[model samples]
Target: MDLDQSTTVESTQSGSSSSGYCRTNSEISGFSEHLTDDFNSCSSETSSPVSWPVTGRSPFRPTLSRFGAIRHDHKLEKDDKLNDQKPTDLELEMMKERFSKLLLGEDMSGSGKGVSTAVTVSNAITNLYVSVFGQHQRLEPLYSDKKRMWKREMTCLLSVCNYIVEFVPASQNLQNKPSMEMMISRLRSDIDINLPALIKLDALLIEILDSFQETEFWYDEQGSMSRNSLSGSFRGAPQPQRKEDKWWLPLPCVPAGGLSETTKKHLRQKRDSANQIHKAAMAINSSILSDMTIPHSYISSLPKSGRTSVGDTIYRSMISTSRFSAEYLLDCLDISSEHEALELADRIEASMYTWRQKACSNYPKSSWEIVKEKMEGDKNVVLAERAEILLFSLKQRFPELAQTTLDTSKIQYNKDVGQAILESYSRVLEGLAYNIVGWIEDVLFVEKSMTNQQES
Candidate 1:
């Protein structure tokens, strides 16, 4: 029952120190000698006394030895000698009986010797050999043309199973932590040492023993049979089917519109921060477009001067939120001038998603450029409409950026630019009361006109 522990136990010999646990050949030989000695002692004590022939006891009956002790001692010596010699029919029969008893965890005391024991032991030995060795074909000689031995062998096997079920868990020292080799060795030893006594076990009990080592059952701690106990036999056999393997626990998702208050708060804060950053970037982008188009006199009309050139400051701001890091932009400029703008655009596009991790939405400065690219490639009006809808979504999600588009007025707006800005502006003010609606309506109407000359 204790599936995890080793069954073979190493004991300290009569003469050796117990500190180290190593078994030398000499120690084994000594142990064998000791077993032999015990057998001799028992046999001598149990042997019938040599008696006087005529007077029945006139000449002192040489002290009668106990017959039982003699039988026990003779069995042991027979077993020890049998290990060296080819097992006799009688010895083999004895072995099978003892094997069964050991497996049943029954006391193997008085079973007599016969051919049946030899056959059973032979088969059990063969089975053990098969259990350890690579191939079954090599052991065909033993089982060939041998039927009675096979029957006896079956009993031995059943008994072995029963023995294991009872023996494994009950042996506390082995149960603690047994090695595989030790278990196998003990199994071999039990068959070797207890053969004669296992001859008498019942057939039904033997079958119960055989099922303990079946392959299909998973013997975890919580399984039907405990490694520590064998109070009951296996009620049923394992099913043949295999179950599918899985890596993760399965669970359902949270419902829509069921956001927690803390989640909503976090989302709002994130949206606000992204909007602020996006607004600063767009302000610079708008300025860059203005600087590219507007005259110096038109620029001078707008704002007060400082140490940083307005154009350079605006360029830096636009480039900062654009996508590529400051270091990358500087490197690209230093490396190449021909595709500087396109390179910058690509970098911005590539880096847009990186910032959206904190924002939950991709409200990068390069988003407008992305929209422009999509618009240029678009053939269907519905596609353009969808793009516009997405743009409106961005404006609603990020109000600060929408406000920036309205406040920065250095560049006169085209029809397309005016419509986009007005849409953003309307979304930003929609939740405000009637008074603010009028103000927003007026801002929508107020657009900077682009003349035919400027367009040309």
Candidate 2:
């Protein structure tokens, strides 16, 4: 059950983590007996938390018409060196955009390129989910049809960071905007004001994750029981059973394992190319972020207490599942046996594979189930938001997102675990905008902060 961690990738200076696994125990075919549960008259043991009222900024709007790809480590003042005798049109345009970014080339930093917190935070979200499929051996057949949950979860986490990054002063006063004291004050006040809302969103996120584990979700027309509750578990010798079993359901998985090896190779190559996000999630303590605090330039905007910045909780939540395999599975499920570990893996796979997108996929609008009374002849009460604007946006974007449904009313969605923020095209557009804005602003934020420090 204990796979060797000898070949694990070394952690980066940013402390990015890498998952490791060894030798597939593919010999074990069918599990002892897939536990078929009867939830006919059952109630969930896991109490859903109170619904948190979420207030989200309409994220992702740009201040510029066109941005050029330019990276430079500037001093506190411009050198004004003309490397080019005559700059080309594109080069000139790029320079203009860069000027706007760096307060008209006032010099945002000294020498070294600053570390972006967005990249660092996003990296933590990715690294923390070190699982059997991605970090372990790359299996092809088990991909595409699954693993999308991870993608969705990643989207939401990045969205939060992206939205924050959008704060880079889009002010026309490029010369006056990057004031050391004023900008610092604004960042602190804004983060403090937003902390309560952030906490509410975090609570809602916890509720969303909790809901996904219900047995109700396990019964979609063609689906089977959850691997979280395998009855006959492992055969050879008796494996330990979880003492407390909840509503006959539990899990999260990405189907990256099912894809073809070619696709696997491509994804692996892409992972290393963008190393910015790896620097994320270096710390998950305290709410006050400052030079006196731990050097968390990557997440200086976030409160020391920020758990998810949306990325923080995700790393913690999925860690359970990623560790839910072979020997490590024992730690997750509180059992110690190789066969049971293997069986649990299969059970989780089976359970995870059942969550398909349907045209009428129905989950609750309220994070917790809210009931209505027929007081004063009440009109009606609605639970699940099952009407799909039907991927009106998917057609233009991911037209292939078939077997689909939509839930427009809900606010919870992510790029990693699973759960669309909303089954709307706006979510997609918003995410794209979030990233674009974040990319531009983070560059300015990191560099501006570092150089401001030197100047002060």
TM-score of each: 0.13, 0.19
The sequence of per-residue lDDT tens digits that candidate 1 reaches over residues 1-456 is 111112212111111111110111110011111112211211233333222133332111221221111111122223334334554676476675545543433324434432233232322332332222112111011222122233333333434222221112222245657633322112223322222222211111112122122221122211333334233322232211211221111111111222345533433333333223223223322332322222344333422321122235323533342442444434434534323332333223223322222222243354544544544533222222332333333332322221222122322232222222222211211111111222212221211111121234
How do the residues 143-183 of candidate 2 rate in per-residue lDDT, one tens digit apiece? 22122323333333334422232244333335756633312
Worst 10 residues of 1 by lDDT: 19-28
Model 1 lDDT, residue 228, Cα: 44
Predicted candidate 2, C-alpha RMSD: 26.4
| lDDT values, one for every candidate | 0.26, 0.24
**Which candidate number would show the highest TM-score if scored against the true structure?**
2
